[model samples]
Target: MDYIHLNEMEFYGYHGVFAEETKLGQRFRLTLSLAVDLKQAGETDELKQTVHYGEVYGLCKDVVEGEPKKLLEAVAEQLASRVMEDFPLIKGVRVLLVKPDPPIPGYYKSVAVELTRGIFV
Candidate 1:
């Protein structure tokens, strides 16, 4: 299967269990991988035949920046669902949401959640 990857998307969002964390906000990075067959798009050479990456980006941005969720797992799951729902051609999708510089006691680089969804229902 052919795949398209969108990586290292950054967004400033207010999402945390702590009050200060929510009020101050932090940086989040999202990466998306979509698996699909591009036969129609390749043959026709038409934009409509393939998945609209711009739309996917916009939707991801909207979801990531829209609401404050305590867990990145929820964000990742929601993103996976939206991608599959919006793009019918995609056979599977993987979503990763990373939180950089989390407010933890020790030194930690980041925390993230990875989710995968298949198109078949």
Candidate 2:
């Protein structure tokens, strides 16, 4: 299996369990690993044979910055679902969602959720 990686894509979003978080919004970081067959792209050197990076980035932006979900899991699920549906070449995806600021009283860099979805019809 071949992979296309998009790392450290950042956006502003309202996603958390606290009211302040939903109202104020915060920064979000997404890293995606797309499972695709790049044999054709390598052989033919055609953009059509592989996924378009801009389109995927746009989709991620739309999803992450669009709505306020209570949990990072929901955001990841939605992203994974949309990616597989929109891109035929993508057979699977790894979605890593990072929340740099959480309301929790803890000392840490960030909190995150990662999910993998694949083999969609």
Candidate topping TM-score: 2
lDDT of 1 by residue, 1-121 (tens): 8888899999988888888778998899999989988888999999988998989999998988879888888878888988999888899998889999788888778888887899522
Each prediction's Cα lDDT score? 0.87, 0.94
lDDT of 2 by residue, 1-121 (tens): 9899999999999988899999999999999999999999999999999999899999999999998999999999999999999999999999999998888997999999999899422
Distance (Å) between predicted and true CA of 98, model 1? 0.6
User: Stretches of candidate 2 above 4 Å error?
Assistant: 119-121
Q: Candidate 2 has which clashing residue pairs, if any? A: none
TM-scores of all predicted structures: 0.92, 0.96
